[model samples]
Target: MSTTPPPDISFEQDALGRLILIAPGGTRHVNVHPAKMFPLTEKDHWISIQSENSREILCVEDPQTLPEPSRSLLLGALARRDFVPIIQVIHRIVRMADGHQWHVTTDRGDTTFEVETDESIQNLGHGRLVIVDRRNTRYLIPSVPSLDRVSKRKLEHYY
Candidate 1:
């Protein structure tokens, strides 16, 4: 079986901190963003670069295939775009008029956020859960079974 070669693309950050894509043959696409096709699963592979209006500019199968500065630049952009905090401890969950307010400590630090509804908490199976806050920020619970007793009890009502 013949494998498709990686896209011949590179990246550059402008003075304003916008991601610029340098395609093959010196074609440049300015102010682009790298979005992971499989962000929750195969994060490092299958990235799509999109324009300001979300138009697909190019698809990179693997950032590792790209040469030096390009690979680093692409990975850096992906890091800034995908920021899902891993919840380590659930301090408290208070019921609000609209939804529930969650106070938890994540891998990043302590934070409090509101969940608009039960539907916002998604179960990805195998004890993996994703809690999306009202602002659309996501917090990941990699393994429900691995959480402490107190934390598990706090989440029992949801699951």
Candidate 2:
């Protein structure tokens, strides 16, 4: 793809390190955030850039379709935004009166979190799962079968 900025659209960073969008008609949108339309399935496609008020400013079909710095900036923004930790192993799960406390090892490191209900655990099919904790932090289990026998056994109780 060309490194040149698309004919009239461009993206840049502001002094405060926020993504700034320079629209086709020379309009500038500041503090614009990028959100994946289909975050789990089509991560690289259909990204929506929104304003501080959460209004859609632009829809990028593919980051690669964008020009130069804009593409790189958008991808970096998405990476920082979609910061889900991948759960590598389940160390323990303690049931409480209110919720279940999960102790696990993730790609980042080991941590414990509280899962309020079974609904917090979502099955994405293809052996994938996403567990949302009480704090609303999402942890990804890329493949259920890939887990160790003990980890799988611990998780079996939930699903």
Candidate 3:
């Protein structure tokens, strides 16, 4: 069994001038502005923190399961003086189609996507792809081009 303790949580800034919270699981809550404090509370299966400007809360469960690079990045940001904390949400998964599409979302209402790889698929079952969001969050998708199906419209636009 592993002997590592739960990851430490900290708030810091990214290169985009947004405030972010580094959770124990290597998951980063980004787009946080300075002078903002996220309200933290522990629940049954997860820990949640709310954004200072909005009521939305990000939650993480068993944060120790996060990978190493994310943990290191968070630690580095906290140690740096210029870093700020911002909240962001990322979801990575392989989507099946003709090419690879990488999508990124931020709290500032900016969305970007680009083609990462291009190839023809004869059989998708043999392909294994890793999709990463933010920095630490990841998921497995069968194909790369399927990400385009996601709607880029904001939640507020519908409400």
Candidate 4:
């Protein structure tokens, strides 16, 4: 970890909920987004600051070291950017020659995604599961055992 001075990070939102970033160069009206350089391992240590157009502005080496308000603001934006709906109900899991189809209900609503194979569902050690679809979107099943009996039975063939 760098012991260097922390970069000034701050933010504001427009009427449409668009983000505005404040920096030493002055406030820039950007659709700024927070991207973790390491999503699973480091979590909050390194982050990429990108614009709405997906352009990289800068990378913060450590968020925990930022000044109080700045740290909170950056973390809040990161939290929103990292939103992933949890699958609560697995209505069905269909196996196919090419791929598998999943019909499930998430915290957000009902949705379906295709998984290329049973390998797509990763057993994250313990009861947790993470399913990556064909398009690369991830559906988090926080705990496999916590799922309803029907979902567990359907998920058995995969893991």
lDDT of 3 by residue, 72-104 (tens): 443343344222222143344245474344444
Prediction 3 global C-alpha lDDT: 0.39
Task: Look at candidate 3 and tell me the lDDT of residue 155.
Answer: 14
Which stretches of model 1 miss by more than 4 angstroms?
1-7
- Residue 1 error for model 4, in Å? 11
lDDT by candidate, in order shown: 0.87, 0.87, 0.39, 0.79
Q: Report the Cα lDDT for candidate 4.
A: 0.79
Give the per-residue lDDT of model 4 (tens digit) for 1-159: 222346655666678766677755575847788788766557768788787788777778887888766688778888877856799999998878899889999999999989998788888767878898998887888888899999999888765
- Tens digits of per-residue lDDT for model 2, 109-132: 999999999999999999899999
Best by TM-score: 2
Order of models, best TM-score first: 2, 1, 4, 3
Per-model TM-score on C-alpha atoms? 0.90, 0.91, 0.22, 0.68
Question: Order of candidates by lDDT, top first?
Answer: 1, 2, 4, 3
Error of 3 at 49 (Å): 4.0
Give Cα distance to truth, residue 130, candidate 3, Å: 44
User: Can you write out model 1's per-residue Cα lDDT over 36-147, one digit (the tens) per residue?
Assistant: 8877788778898898899887788878998878788888889889999999999999999999999999999999999999999999889989999999998999999999
CA RMSD per model (angstroms): 2.9, 3.7, 15.6, 3.8
Off by over 4 Å in 3: 1-13, 16-30, 33-45, 52-54, 72-159
Collision count of model 4: 0
